[model samples]
Target: MDALDDLDLRVSGCRACPRLVDWREEVARTKRAAFADQTYWGRPVPGFGPPDARLLIIGLAPAAHGGNRTGRMFTGDRSGDVLYQALYDVGLASQPTSVAADDGLELYGVRVTAPVHCAPPENKPTPGERETCRPWLVQELRLLRPTVRAVVVLGAFGWQATLPALAEAGWRVPRPRPAFGHGVRVGIDRSEGSVGGGGPAGLDLFGCFHVSQRNTFTGKLTPAMLREVLSTAARAAGLGK
Candidate 1:
């Protein structure tokens, strides 16, 4: 837990990507009209949840006015509304809403994080930026590897980013990696010489559509759909019903 705390501090101070650094700070400075009176957490956001979590939820990136302003992954965002509510429905989260960092929300047996920690321009991080920020995810997974048995990746971008991070953390990913799609599931084996031992009995990865406004508003991802995936993931992680 101390190590995870240290990693969070390290992540908060990172300025490896010049573009992301400038953009995140600029948004903080300019301020959105609705959030004019609030100060933004204009730095790389850290993963949130218990260190011994068996279920891991991976997202693409933070929303500019959402996490960038609140300092918590998925907080103060429309996407978070859908995601958290579904998590709550499945017994993974204690609450259905996440408004601010200190909103008294708690996750049970689950951790929420993103591939890219900082909020990017247009809600999209460039390929280079993703690669630059990859090490953080790698280190985070390394710390959580022992307990994390089920990973729920939101969107194809998260799926792609997470696979490499898992591999770097010693999980043996299949060659010609499995493609990402809503409800897709892939079983990853741990390397023989890896921390947890290599075998068929390893982590289970699940794919789900991102809880973005575009997806939810257009019915690309519904509340019931997200709950189903999360419930399945919880069971896979041995969290029980």
Candidate 2:
């Protein structure tokens, strides 16, 4: 297991962010039986991929009834179901199902991470919390060296968190990085003080509307669109047939 794997053991009852801790605990009390005996992994969910994973999926934060409750990123949620199906179809996952934490699913060469590890109230994390949670992401990126070639940022928040890391590594992001439509690729280059974002950043950062309830409910993103994005990203990552 990578260092990322141990985050659950380290801080499930994390107190780093007081607001998140209180909110998660509050939910745990009301829905105790629903999550009976299950450890609320309210801590940061680390990246789940091999050291040499080619694609990195960055999400915003954990869901209260989802990742925090199930102890797996994106599990026990609708968004996860869609995301996992697309991932399996793209040949990056070893299993086709991601219904629950113990669904016996596995990723082949991709890892999913959230900008903020803790599940935020109403699924929205404040700016301060996002900032507080970013250091873990940076650490994970550093340990995942020589393997991450591309990143699929799920939303604007995720995109924002990941861009600076790429830029510091010498990947130049085009001004504004344009807008958030899928299948778009803007270049990234390290700015003047970007120590981590230097050299020939082989990572291709793809932006997509988050696989969230809002997008799914509004029909803004379809299953086909998700599959297409996954296919494109996987081919770029050299995982496609």
Candidate 3:
């Protein structure tokens, strides 16, 4: 397989964080009452999308019963319901729902990933765990740097995590770093200089509230709001033309 495939395979096998490994495996074995008959992936979830994508979406981490069970980022959860529907509405995704890894949902020119690959307890990954998982994201960003033109970071946690990874991947994150805010957009330039003589390739970074039940249920993030952000980022990535 290629570099991305290799990276993904490696990601799926990671057990670097003892806490996350224990939590994820326990959750998998216990099995949610609704899904008792189903088998859980119970491993580090890999990034989902084509290798050379133009748009990247960053999330905090997998939900305990969501990605940890489905084995795909943003799958089998209410959060995924909001995210996928918005993506589909903006013409970035082939389907309006993401239930399973084998669901056949396709993302056009976009990839989805997280700072922490495994689901964390109480949906919160410790700072140490986040750091431990950084290498995988750093490598994934490097692999996508040539083609990725824009990124949409969901939630402040993802926004904070991704800025450092972006800098490590070749982009020059601004001094003071951009603050995370819904509907925020920042332009980042390549620190290493031009790409294909393209005069210092840059990337568009957009921020959106997390599509968690807390946000959606409270109307902190509406369908229209989510779509607007995705559409804007999709256009920046030269998609939907």
RMSD of each: 1.6, 2.9, 2.0
Greater-lDDT candidate between 1 and 3: 3
TM-score of each: 0.96, 0.86, 0.96
Residues 21-73 of candidate 1 have per-residue lDDT tens digits of: 99999999998999999999999899999988899999999888999999999
Model 1, CA-based lDDT:
0.91
List model 2 lDDT by residue over 173-195, tens digit each: 67765666577775544344345
- Writing each residue's lDDT as its tens digit, candidate 3 over 126-156 gives 8888889998998998888779999999999
Q: Which has the better lDDT: candidate 2, or candidate 3?
A: 3
**After aligning candidate 1 to the native by TM-score, how far in Å is the CA of 130 from where it should be?**
0.6
Q: What residue pairs are clashing in model 3?
A: none
Range of the 10 consecutive residues with the lowest summed lDDT in candidate 1: 192-201
